[model samples]
Target: MNLIKPHDRISLAEKIGRPSVALVVDDFYNRVQTHPTLAKPFSIVAHWQEHKQRITEFWWIALGGKPTASYSYDPVSKHFLAGFNQTLLSDWKALFFEVTHTHLSPELASAWQQRVEMIGENLLRQNDKLLGDRGRPST
Candidate 1:
């Protein structure tokens, strides 16, 4: 059996660090705010700075860094409320990949991108189930 467990492995948070993560989030969100398709969904975000900070923290913890602040991230509910359709999610993923690739090393970007795919897929599935039960897919 493998000696290193999932939690025991060196985290991407440690390797990529918070700075790079924050940089990507900042840049990506900036572009997203102005993006034709992305802008509409993101319009719900009241404060851009606050959103970036929280998202940066979210990614940091997701990549296995220790939490520096407490937060209750209800992403599925939020995205459902935001009316995130497949197109929006697809655009988000493409833009995110672009930003990460520009900001991080190829290997690091690939690693982080994989995690994003897994989480995003799960989010999409959960959001779809919830929204579908309500008799409509998010637009």
Candidate 2:
């Protein structure tokens, strides 16, 4: 079965551009490092620069851009190991949206934000199944 991403081939990365993707990733993580609730959950990352670069690629691919590198991602495993919970995921999403709005125009940011919400729901489900952390975000 050829699995297609839910957002399909919209090429949002091309529309939003590579530089803005990097900007969002960098800005989001930079805030995460100091976020009162996220500081500890994200403390697992030892290298901010490397993490940001990888995540930039992740967003690029998720937004329908062609892959620029061969780096593999296992978000479920990574999030589980990071001790992710509903609260952290919620905070992460909030901060992520905040950063995107800062760097991207309203329409592009909303488009990317919709895909990210899909990712968030998936992560929350998988993390719960693997780690037995079952809870909804504090919405």
Candidate 3:
């Protein structure tokens, strides 16, 4: 018997469809908190809950492809400014992949993976330009 059952992609979409971006932020925050290296960076924010909501909204905007009336800060710039290196970025990607694999359907997983990879690549490029090759030193 196949231990892994197929997930309902429609159901997953529906679940993500409801409510505000807070859910995604909460999930991201939870993952960051549990990660050894991520926890410190995530803890830097004084208002974690608010930060989480903003991050969640950012993801929602990226995935949902909708217009965001609120928040004007750019996520890519924020992350780079946060002093994240390549290892931390890789850790973030790994955690994201693991979370999607465990919680999302195959279709959703594929979509998320593509989206994250694009974002990560862009961030890496931006970081390289800003801090030089010594900053991340790609691995």
In candidate 3, which residue ranges exceed 4 Å CA deviation?
1-16, 19-24, 133-135
Model 2 pairs in collision: none
Which of the two, 1 or 2, has more TM-score?
1
RMSD of each: 2.5, 5.3, 7.3
lDDT of 2 by residue, 1-139 (tens): 9989966655888999999899888888889889999999888899999999899999899988999998999999988888877778778888888988888889998999999899999988887788554454353
Query: With candidate 1 superimposed using the best TM-score fit, by how many Å does residue 42's alpha carbon deviate from the native?
Result: 0.5
Point out the worst 10-residue segment of candidate 3 by lDDT: 6-15
Best of the two (2, 3) by lDDT: 2
TM-score of 3: 0.74
Tell me the RMSD of model 1 versus the true structure. Answer: 2.5
lDDT of 1 by residue, 21-130 (tens): 99999999999989999998889999999999999999999999999889779888888889877778889999999999999999999999999899988887887798
As for lDDT, the candidate ahead, 1 or 3, is 1
Q: In model 1, how large is the Cα lDDT of residue 24?
A: 96
**Residue clash pairs of candidate 3:** none
Better of 2 and 3 by TM-score: 2
Global lDDT scores for all candidate models:
0.90, 0.87, 0.70
